[model samples]
Target: MLEHAFVDQDGLHDFVFGGDGLSSRYDCLVITSQRAVEAVGAVLARAPSAAARARVLAMPAYTVGPATAALLASVGFSNVLGAGDAGNGSVLADIIVADATRQGALRCIFFPGRVRKDVLPQKLRAAAAVECDERVVYESRGVEGADAALRAALDAAGGAAQRAAPRAARTWVVFFAPGGADAAAATVAGRRLPAAAIGPTSAEFLAARGVRAAAVAAKPDPASLLAAIAAADAHDV
Candidate 1:
């Protein structure tokens, strides 16, 4: 049922309204980086000053999550707000709509990875004539050939150990995304290894093949996955 991605909009709307309104030079921009804030911070630092730079520099950042907000803060951009503890895109989108209503004109530049969904920008543009732009900073290519070959080899060998006599094997299946879910399923399909999913999305992906997705984490990230695995172990005992 999940559709869109999580974007962070920290105090960006407040900065917009607090500023001298929308600049005739250019207005607010909403940029997102699912890849950690450090990555986005680098992009922001290197981005040319010509293509709506000052606008981004002046406005408070709306990020994809807390990591991104922290990255912005690290880079010295103040007025960040959106994601406080609940770091996700849905919450940020709601904040964008509410803030835009009070601010009048809101421009945005959304920076996304290769796998981002388009619901937020679509919804925001429909609500207001916000100056929104899409910028891609990095791309994710599929793992193939020797690199993937090594991983596949590891799975094939480890998969047997994972499935052995004990159903409660210590094998940990780290699901990063929908694709990662598929990969994990394929790797341990016939094996009796226990799995720990990253989120509902990955769970759904596994469930399609009749695999009961247990130990789902709070979020679809590495740290969350690790936490979920630990919790699952505790519950198992």
Candidate 2:
């Protein structure tokens, strides 16, 4: 049986929005995750003027994938576009560039997590001369230590022998974010295990810690996670 590692953290709560240069409409609104969409909703909820809210609602919205687009739609964002299955900043940048080339250079506002890569904005500027503004709506912080279940599991798994066991006997741990990787590293304390990551960024985080991921999901979603596990299993075989 696979032992799951859990990181207990205060979920996304800090949100800051509304400032100079922020208006009702933009060429595009880029949201990177469901948390980012939630943050946008929070910002809209606090809008001081109805006209301001209306302006934001009227803007075209874009997201990294269908999941985030669906979340935006649920919150009454009718004009929304998604980059499909491979949801990442890089893919989103490509879509933004292609759209800008066809339609015209666009002014975009980005709602991203606190810890984000500059790839999307850099690509947009380089490929389409698009002007982009960013606001961080949420941040994830790692727990101070492993949760009880994770600690117990690690204890049960024991030392190097278990860590170096055959792939069939090892449970593949899947990390969804860099924070998760940080938590896992703290929890495992140098004990290596078969691991997988949801995307390239998370995989890179693991690699930086000398924990090479067996597989990386094409997208940051549960279905992709399963696919990553299957790929890892195949690699192990």
Identify the leading candidate in terms of TM-score: 2
Worst 10 residues of 2 by lDDT: 6-15
* Worst-scoring 10-residue span by lDDT in model 1: 1-10
Candidate 1 residue 16 C-alpha distance from true site, Å = 17
TM-scores, all models, native as reference: 0.62, 0.78
| lDDT of candidate 2 over 29-119, digit per residue (tens) | 8887777787677667766677767667767788866667778888777788764744777887888778887886788878777667778
> In terms of lDDT, which candidate is strongest?
2
After TM-score superposition, the amount by which residue 63's alpha carbon in candidate 2 deviates from its true location, in angstroms, is: 1.5
lDDT of 1 by residue, 73-151 (tens): 6676666767453344555677787777788867665666545556667777677646566655444444545345645
Q: What is the Å distance of residue 49 in model 2 from its true position?
A: 5.6
**Any runs in candidate 2 off by more than 4 Å, and if so which?**
1-25, 48-51, 147-149, 157-170, 186-189
Which regions of candidate 1 deviate over 4 angstroms?
Answer: 1-31, 34-40, 47-55, 126-131, 146-169, 177-213, 219-223, 234-237
Q: In model 1, what is the error at residue 37, expressed in angstroms?
A: 4.7
